[model samples]
Target: PTMEDFLQPGNKQVAAGYVIYGSSTMLVYTTGRGVYGFTLDPSIGEFCLSHLNIVTPPDGAIYSINEGNYNHFPEGVKKYIEYCKQEDKPTKRPYSARYIGSLVSDFHRNLLKGGIFMYPPTASAPKGKLRLIYECNPIAFLAEQAGGIATDGKNRILDIQPESLHQRVPLYVGSKNMVQKLQEFL
Candidate 1:
């Protein structure tokens, strides 16, 4: 895909993000002034700016994973999803459930509201879903430049030099606070 596919005229898009569901799934995006994510809030009937800056909290209260694919995930991922699920219990803060089945939608929420969007390597697709040059690279540039963090759950997305145009990689993005924590887990 090209840059023009995501950029719209007079749409007032401060930032843009999206998920490409292929053999796996990927989330890619960009921003105009500051990075902004598009969150689908049925209550609002539109994708609003749920997160302003990509500052991760020291202890992120929410986590997102494709539970339907749980059987195909790695132990690390299973463990993490377990932690998110635990929030539903009485002891936790009742971390909310938000899986729009759309990468842009999910990342938009995490970027704006402060959380993490993970697309780690699963058993089916070991390299992950997102393409570095066409997808992650652009979004990573926008996110980090706008006070957010973009990574492969371990290293900075911008630092990962690409050898091909469609190189794929796992992606972990959002507020720096949460991003740092997720990095530790990886």
Candidate 2:
């Protein structure tokens, strides 16, 4: 296969999302135009209409990340978290903190509700935990298509070509407004 076989550099990806295996299995994805969701009908063994064209809000009242390992994150991230804590009425500061440690859940919520989810490179693991190909690229595609942004601090997540499989990188993905404001703190 040619370079076309790889979707590492997220720019090549037309769409991406995952199914939530809850009351039903739902598939949500975007094709650079809009995001859609389909529910699996077990009885008919077919995907049925569940969600029509979905769009994320410009901002929200929550931010998601693993704050339990706060000490491991870089100084910039620490500072940003502090900033998020400080109350600012004008800009709607003191946002709620939410972390489920599951990409599908955290990202899906942020995708629909308009928040930010981040995985930053730290003192020990400089590259961060999220894989460039299998995880970040696809998620970034969906985020962008839904009017959001995804980045690895200094670079766009979709712009990075993997040096190898299992390559890890930091990720900041969600509402365009939230991601932009977070970048300022970083």
CA lDDT of every candidate:
0.62, 0.86
* Candidate 2: tens digits of C-alpha lDDT, residues 93-141: 8988999899888988898788889899877788898899989888888
How does model 2 fare in lDDT?
0.86
Native RMSD of candidate 2 (Å): 1.9
- lDDT of each residue in 2-114, candidate 1, tens digit only: 75443322132345456545443434345655544445555656556554544434344555666788788767666666665564445354556577766666765565566
- Model 1's TM-score against the true structure: 0.65
Top-scoring candidate (lDDT) = 2
Specify the poorest-scoring 10-residue window by lDDT in model 1: 4-13
Candidate 1, superposed: residue stretches over 4 Å from native: 1-33, 36-60, 87-94
Q: Best candidate, TM-score-wise?
A: 2
User: TM-score of every model?
Assistant: 0.65, 0.91
